[model samples]
Target chain A: MTGLSFRYGERVALDEVSLSAEAGRFTALLGPNGAGKSTLFSLLTRLLISRQGQIRIAGHDLERQPRAALAALGVVFQDATLDLDLTVAQNLRYFSRLHGLPPRQAEQRAEEELTRLGLWERRNEKVRALNGGHRRRVEIARALLHRPAVLILDEPTVGLDPPTRRLLVDHIHQLCATTGMAVLWATHLIDEVDPISDRVVILHRGRIRAAGDVPVVLAAAHSDSLADAFRHFTPESPPAQEAC
Target chain B: MPWLLALRGIVGREILRFLHQRERFLGALVRPLIWLLVFAAGFRAALGVAIVPPYQTYIPYEVYIVPGLLGMIQLFNGMQSSLSMVYDREMGSMRLLLTSPLPRWWLLVCKLVAGVAVSLLQCWAFLLIATLFGIELPGPGWLTVLPALILNGIMLGALGLVLSSTIRQLENFAGVMNFVVFPLFFCSPALYPLYKMRESSETLYWICEINPFGHGVELIRHALYGQVSWPDLGMVTAVALVLLALAVRGYDPRRGLMKRKGG
Candidate 1:
């Protein structure tokens, strides 16, 4: 993304935002509530286009070649996008069809992902019957079904228990390490960012306050901990009347 | 081929949802049946029917209102699907659908086609009930009316799409009923002939004459008798195309309703 900006009418939700994540790396986008993390995800997913800037996913321009750009992306939105009425396998099949995968390939991929996620035993169960952790796993599996070049997750572990959250975080990190997939994980949870995370981009009020390797950001903020670095970059309150 | 597969998936989802919601099917049939069975019986004597343009001979009130009731089924089903669209938007499934790599217009068309398919099923169910009640159309009319039904279904579904794009909340659906469904049903010649409406008020007659729903009913009525009405067909086709274009524009991410966060 290059100078990506977005606004809802007069309220600027993202101001000249720009960031990048390389292959085989896990990048944490840390931000507070209403820090334009979701907005950035929306732009990346092409749900809301940014008029002022450009986004290229896997070398495909989002605006000029949206279909290619979108095809290269795998997204797990903040909200649960699964159909509660459909079985886990059924949900995956439906999404694969949307991605234009053939029946045999779709089924094979669904099985592969479900097995990898260790949810193969529960594939026939309805999504509504699954617990939060399992459901999140199913979503992650669905996102991977198309074998997208980049995986974008917006707060994938928002409401899970601590153990489940840790498990999911580790799973994503493993995916990055093994598949060499560029992963952009957005969250406000500092602990979710592992000490070995390749990079951290801290956004506050629609602007990138600090972005770099964890130790570099820590050094730049003159702090020992990632949480303290986040606090130092993002003040408790904004200066009055400045644009977001 | 990919387009065809996506279409099948989307349409299949709609069908599955329709099947699951038995109450929705029953509600759609029950509303039209009430109008056909009880309401028509009550109003039959009060409102006399002369030789309407679509009807060569004098027809019973129930027979006259059947096409209008068919329009009603499509109208309500169209709105119901749009209601689901709003729900999907709020639930984030719509976001998932929009993010698909397919062209936005094609995706919306898939949604419209799914809605029309459900509406067609409801129309046939209503016709079957009407046939049971001794309001059978000409034998060949069954085959002939397919095109008309499909056209009307698209028209009403497109209108629903337009409304869905503008409506921000699911709670505001009641407002749509009052402003859109009711007016479109009542203002058109769906329940009465234009001449009959003119007997009450000239302004209302003109309103009915111009209503695309009115032309839709006229087109279906003609097709029911294995006949054709070029003017009505043309009007319905034109209206449907225009409304569909508007609906496509309404769903555009940069400019349409999805641009707003809460909306």
Candidate 2:
């Protein structure tokens, strides 16, 4: 988005927030707590709307053609949204049908996603019976069932163990590589940012502090490590170390 | 085709959830039956029945209240939708439904349809019980009442939708809804006829006359006798459309009650 700005009455949540995510690339939107990462995600998902700037998904403008733009995008919100009363396969099928998938194709894709996520055997189990890690995986699987061109996840690992987080991160990176899908990952943990593969955009106090490849961000901050780079970018409020 | 599929998914999920909550289905059914078998039994000695328009002869008090009991089931179902909607909004599940990439209005309407489907099930169950209880009615009335039942169901369900979107949080829900559910139910011709209220109080009669729930009950009463009230149907249709339009507007991201979150 270019020149995108938003406010909650008096306080500005995001100011002139401009960034881009390219196909086959993972852009990590790194920020401190209350740094507007969620606000930005809400805008991208069209849960919130602003008329200040441009947002395009697969070259379809968001405001002018929201249906086309949103159809091409997949999202996993920060909260657990799966219906606990429904079985794993039921949740997936519900989302698939919402996207207009045929019954036969919806079932096939749901199975493939559940299996790809190593959740095939538990497909009939109620989601309330699953642990946090498994629930996040189910949500991820649901997001990918429609094969969206662009994927976005907001703090998807907030409640999971480190091992599960690492597994999910690796799996998503592999998805970005193999599927040629554009990915925007918003997080506060500095450990999730890799200096070699992923691009980084540091947001501080509702503005982009630094943005580029990991190495470029480090070089711009005159630091060798991402921790120092993050400190340099967000001098007002440091990273949420507890999150790391 | 996709819109239809989404509606099926939404309505199916609601029914599935309703069935899973056996207590809820039983609870929905218990309220109307109590009024039928318990309250109406005592109410019979106190209230005398005259030749009302829908009644050809002086009918029993239980028979007089069958349509009102049906209206109560729908009214409670509509309020149930409101409670669940508020809970869903708090739980983040509502976000999943709203962001379906379909036109937002269509999604909200699908939810409305889902609520109506569940109410229809409970109404049918209640009617079946009434039939078994030896309450006599025209045999063809069963088929005739379907359309009126659906129309009244939508009108009330849409009211629930409007209530959900208008209220921002759950803590303030019950108090606000009581003000709505009780007043609308009691003031309507659900329990007693408007003419009875007219003899007691002039103001009360006009309130009943203006209440859409009364029209809904009247419509159902007429339909159950293989009749229709065009005026009541028109009132209900206009009210349903207006409420639905408001609900659709209320859920919009740029302008609606959801935006009050500012998150």
Candidate 3:
């Protein structure tokens, strides 16, 4: 999909924003606060409808085939979505079932994914007892249980420590590399957008200020650091909520 | 397939949560038991039962009102579940369920079914206790009450779903209870039959005739007495469908019910 735009009343959240994360690529949606990154994620995931633009997930038009589009995308929401009352295994099993997995396969997949996340030891523990980082791992594992072609994570490492964040980002990149899946990872942290492996799309005031290879975009602005390039392109005091 | 899975997932989540909160189950059972045992006992001498339509011979006040009392428990539990939905929405969990790759209608139906299941369990438990208090129904009344409980549970749960989706925040729920619930209960034929209301106020009797809660209570009364009131059943079913449709419409993302004030 291309040229997707959205507005809240008269104020715009995305102004003719066009970007794509092709298969086997990790696309980082880089923007400062209030730059409409979350709004863009909302459009791509079909959480919020767009009157001005469109989105296509895994070759399926979101508007024309919403269910198929959603089915093709595995999303780990910015906020925690785990059922706090359920065990880790129960949570994954339920999510797998929601994706139409049979009961036996769902349970098997749940165990396999939890084991991969280093959470098999705590599979029977209630989600409420898990620490924040572990809870995030559970959510990530749950998202992947469906095995979608495109994985979208909105601010997945928001509350994690630096080491934990790096681990998650590495894990995501490795998964995309091995599975040849497209990934749209939205975050405000500049360092999280790797200069070598990932593409960068910078959003500023509901518009795409720059979109290309990470180093190329930064070099075009005559900046060496991603953070400096982001500040230069995304205006201060943006008129939107972007604390993703 | 996806819709079925979504239904099962949401219902399973709700059931698991309910099970974990043991106090909530106890609280749901205790509230109605108090009214059935204590309040009915104190008021039995003051209130006289006229031969209601479902009644063949004059019944004691406690026995006559048991069905209504059971309906009240389910009704309140439905609202309580709705209250939790609102709370969950505010806390960001309901969004997960809503955004699943399933039809919103199916997700909602699952919610209604889960609520009805929990309500049915509570109804049976309440019936067993009430039977111990000499408030007994026909031998096959338990069999008949199943359908009645299902109908009433869906109707009440649908109302709760609509209320939860329409309300923006949790703080406004109390006002909803005070404004919407108390009037609905007191103005219905739960406490007194329409014929009894006619002796005091013809206007109220007319009001009771139109209230959906009255139909629900009467449906339960008919079933508990081994009689079928097809009209009451039809009315409750129609209301349930209407309410469920509205709730689905209100929660649609194209016109999200969670609009902010002055937006």
Candidate 4:
């Protein structure tokens, strides 16, 4: 995405924001509450159109070729989007059909994804019967069923336990590494960003405060820990040298 | 072909959800049943009817109100479908749907089609109950009314889509009931003939005459007797098309109500 900007009436949600994620890399979008991370995700997913910028997903411009762009993109929103009454496999199959996959292919993909996520045994259980962690896993599995070129997750670990959060973070990172899929993981939790993250984009007040490789962002902020670097870039912090 | 597949998936999901919520099915039936059984029995004596174009002879009050009650089922079901749309938005499922690679118009049309499909089921169920109560249509009337019911279902469902797009929060749905559903149902020829409304008040008679729901009921009522009303069908078709376009525009994220709420 380049020069993307959006406003909700008078309030600017994202202002001239431009960022990119590379395939086979995990890019962390770190921001505090109300910092426009969700807005950016909304734009990337084409849920909200950006009037001021261009977004290209897998070489398909969002505005010019939305179908192709959206076809290549996968998203797991902050809230659980699964039909609670439907079973795990049923939810995945529904998603597969939404992507226009044939019945045989959809069934196979659902099996493969559910098995990969370790939810295969409970595939027949309704989603309402599953725990929160399992539900989130189902959503992640559903998102990956289409084998999208880019995966966008918005604050995916909001209510999970520490162990589950760690597990999910690791699983997505593994997906990035093994499948060569670009990932934009949005979270306010500083711990989710570690030394392994290929790139970090810190957003504050609808603009990019710092964006670069982990080491470069850390060095630019002159902070040893990511937590401190994040604090330094936020609006609440006192004036510091510009990191961008 | 892909669009067809997605349409089938969406429509199938709606049917599954409808089946799961047995209470909704029951409620959709009960509302109109009461109007047909108890209310129509009382109104039968109080209200007298003359030979209308759709009816060659004076019909019983219950007979006149069956088409109206049919419209009521679609009306309530349509609003209920929109209520679910608002709930889906709150629960984030609507976001998943809107982000599909298909054209946005096609997606909304799929939703409309699904809503119409469910409404048709409810309509048939009610008709069966009405049949059990000794109210039967003319031979072949049952088959002929299918197209009219489908058309009316699309019209009402499209109106629901328009409402769902404008209503930002779930809490505001009751407001839709008061402002949209009640007015659209009460003011139309669904409950009474337009000439009867004219006898009471000219303003209301014109209002009912112009109401698309009134035209829908007229179309269904005529078709229920194995007759046709080209003007009523044309009116309903035009209104459905116009409202459907408005619904599509209302959901457009860039310029529609979704943008206003920053969804």
Q: What's each prediction's TM-score? A: 0.96, 0.98, 0.95, 0.96
Q: Candidate 2's C-alpha lDDT?
A: 0.88
Q: Give the TM-score of chain A in candidate 1.
A: 0.96
Candidate 3 DockQ score?
0.48
RMSD of 2: 1.4
Among these predictions, the greatest TM-score belongs to 2
lDDT of 1: 0.88
Second chain only: TM-score per model? 0.96, 0.97, 0.94, 0.96
Segments in model 4 whose C-alpha atoms lie over 4 Å from true places: A235-244, B260-263
Please state the error at residue A203 of candidate 4 in Å: 0.8
Best by DockQ: 2
* iRMSD per prediction, in order: 2.1, 1.7, 3.3, 1.9
lDDT of 1 by residue, A131-231 (tens): 99999999999999899999999999888888888889889999999999999999778887876766899888899999889999999999998878888
Better of 2 and 3 by TM-score: 2
For residues A1-244, what per-residue lDDT tens digits would candidate 2 score against the true structure? 7888988878998899899998998899988888988888878888889878788888989998988888898999898899999999889888987888899999999989889999999999999999999999999999998899999999998878999998998889999999999999998887776668999999888899999999899899999988888988888785545323
The C-alpha RMSD of each candidate to the native structure, in angstroms, is: 3.4, 1.4, 2.6, 2.8
Model 3, stretches more than 4 Å misplaced?
A: A237-244, B258-263
Computed on alpha carbons, the lDDT of every model, listed in order, comes to 0.88, 0.88, 0.82, 0.88
What is the total number of backbone clashes in candidate 1? Answer: 0
Cα-based RMSD of candidate 3: 2.6
Quote the B-chain TM-score, candidate 2.
0.97
